[model samples]
Target: MNHDAYPDNYIRGILNSVKSIAMVGASPVNVRPSYFAFKYLAQRGYDMIPVNPGHVGKDLLGKPFVASLRDIGRPLDMIDIFRNSSHIMPVVEEALTLDPLPKVIWMQLGARDDAAAAKAEAAGIKVVMNRCPKIEYGRLSSEISWMGVNSRTLSSKRPPAPTQGMRLSINRMSVGGGDTAASDRAAKNKSEQS
Candidate 1:
């Protein structure tokens, strides 16, 4: 997968496959991006765990924080790193030692380490860099577009009425989704038209 660009399907697949996520560098403050992302994924029904050594005893959105990845005490589908780029490798190394390795190592927006990503990929793990799962989830589900954001997907209709209130699946609108260049073109066109 390209570190600079991601196809919608790649993101959708991760989001759909990941039932549990370990959010490294999660924050107690509600205003932080980590807090918001954790809350959003948790609300979306993903089993979200917060990993922050400084706040191990604290809770974020009802989930108690763990000091490190090993403390999770359960298998994880993904590890969403919110730490700075320089700190990614240590986290990835620690993740590699887990018994049932995580399926994905996702570096958050503005937080990417090419070497760490390569290491994870070498271990047959999927890697995502410089992206936010929260944003991707919203974009793929057309939830963000409801707020007038360009989701890079074209659709003439809305998804079926939710069985649950305001809940959306990653499969909402998949048009122009899998091709990175194509999706960029669509977004560019939509932006230019606006």
Candidate 2:
């Protein structure tokens, strides 16, 4: 899988539409990314089912944890995977075997298994690889609310500012509607007259 296959629109759609998510390999450890991501989404009004074999029967974020997708015993909109690529296939296989399969399979950053992804995609499951739902949600949902990025901001990182005049002009043109061509010509004429 070209890592770029995960589109922003797809991520946004999942983030908006899915009310309940089954988070595989979800950890209760505060330091883990999955723990924070799951908590963040839950706080955003998503019903998060924490799935980890070791954590079965444990409580996380006021919800009872299940060992696997099958143990959850209900329909799920999506599964946000925090597991490594090597451990993904079994989860994909199990997801397929669910009575009501999930709509999407999202693999977190640095996690991508082509064969597992193919299986999910072939089963009509929307596949997102090498992306974090938390980061994508922050971006597409406009939750960042800041231009500059830092430890304070949640975006992956911002690209450098445009260097060329044409790039700046195009950015302005894309946002505002006016007689831009005529305005440019008039501006050029005024500059020449000066």
- For each candidate in turn, the TM-score is 0.86, 0.73
For 1-194, candidate 2 gives per-residue lDDT tens digits of 34444334455566767777999989999999999888877766678999988988788889888987988888999998999879899999999998778988888876777789899989898888777777666544444435432212123445446343211110110112322346445544553454
lDDT by residue (1-194, candidate 1, tens digit) is: 66656767788888888899999999989899999999888888889899999997779878899999999999999999999989999999999999899999999987777788899999999998778998998888877877877777766775677654355766755655444676545644553454
Structure candidate 2, residue pairs in collision: none
TM-score of 1: 0.86
Question: Model 1 segments beyond 4 Å from truth?
Answer: 162-167, 172-194
Assess each prediction's global lDDT (C-alpha) against the native. Answer: 0.85, 0.71
- The RMSD of every model to the true structure, in order and in angstroms, is 5.4, 15.0
Best by lDDT: 1
